[model samples]
Target: MHFLRYQWEPYLSYGQLFEFEKNKVVYHQGEAGRGIYYLKNGEIKVTLLSDKGDERIINMVPPGMLFGEHGIHGEPYLTSGTTTCPSLVYYFSDDVIATICRKHPEAAGIYTDSLIYKFRTLAEIIAHLDSPVEQQMAFYLLKLVQENGNASMNQTAFAKYIGTSRITVNKIIQKWKQKGYIELHKREIIIMNFDKIRAIASNPHMD
Candidate 1:
């Protein structure tokens, strides 16, 4: 949080900002913005749309995490991010960002680190593409369970994260459910078996 405050205080000086409601688009995939975001509250889903109009969730944006970092790449915005709840976002223009970097080179490194980790995650996905969908889904469910504090996990959200449709997720969830591996009620998904799930995720190869 301290790192964010260090990076954020400078942007506040510019005073350009916007707020968004649940499911509202903060920016589209190809729009331009000069500043990064400091998420004060709520959550956002970073996503991309297929040519066929399907949504692919890339990541969940939690509080205190930065988004719209394509400013570093000189693009307007790389992908669209929408809120899951009402959100407060600070928008800083390019001029404002430049001023901040001038004063704090370390802040630039922090931003670069964030982007690099994303790229590394993409690399890992490519390497794991050959893995079975069941393992892939299991791996992702475990991640959500951890990230969301094992709270309610919506099947649609899981499907989006796995880059598949909800129906596919439902089918896979059904298999797990029958095996007493999970419990699903409405939008809630509860993992009942951790060892088996982890073993599936730990498979050295994507079978």
Candidate 2:
């Protein structure tokens, strides 16, 4: 959960800062990769649009993360990025980023590390595709807590993010509530038994 915070302000001086309202689309799939973005604050959802117009939630980018790196290669963006809340994002043109990296080679490591982390996460997701729903939900809930300090996503959104039906998510959540593993608030879910949740997440086969 720890992120390396590079001294990027000086190198990113040429970058433009833009504020986006909640649910605002920063970029769309198939758009020319103009530049990568640095998220100064707030959350962003990266999604992929299928040929049949089906949209899948890829991952959520938290503050201080670098996204839209596909723009660096000058190809079309494979996924669309949208703000989940009011957000401050810095847009760095591809050429400018290249120049900065050329002049400051160390800066390139930051992006490299970020990209590696993203790829690792994607791999983990793929590996867990056939995992029990409870285990996947537990893992995702822990991830949300780590990133946002709580599980704030609603059941519908949570289900979509985990690639499961809302009914399935609701059933597991209700069971957790009855078992005193979590507490459901008006808008958030609080983990009451972190150890138990972690155990389930790590070993789904355990009772």
lDDT for 108 in candidate 1 is 77
Listed in order, each prediction's TM-score against the native is 0.77, 0.88
User: What CA root-mean-square deviation does each model show from the true structure?
Assistant: 3.7, 2.2
- Scanning candidate 2 in windows of ten residues, the lowest lDDT window is 1-10
Candidate 2 is scored at a TM of 0.88
Off by over 4 Å in 1: 1-17, 51-53, 125-130, 146-152, 184-188, 204-207
- Candidate 2 per-residue lDDT, tens place, 1-207, comes to 456443455565767999999999998889889988888888888877757776766678877777887767678887889998999999988788888899889888887887776667667776776888899999888987886677877898888767879899999999989999999998699999999899989997763
lDDT of 1: 0.70
The residue pairs that clash in candidate 1, if any, are 32-76, 35-92, 131-206
Residue 178, model 1: lDDT of: 92
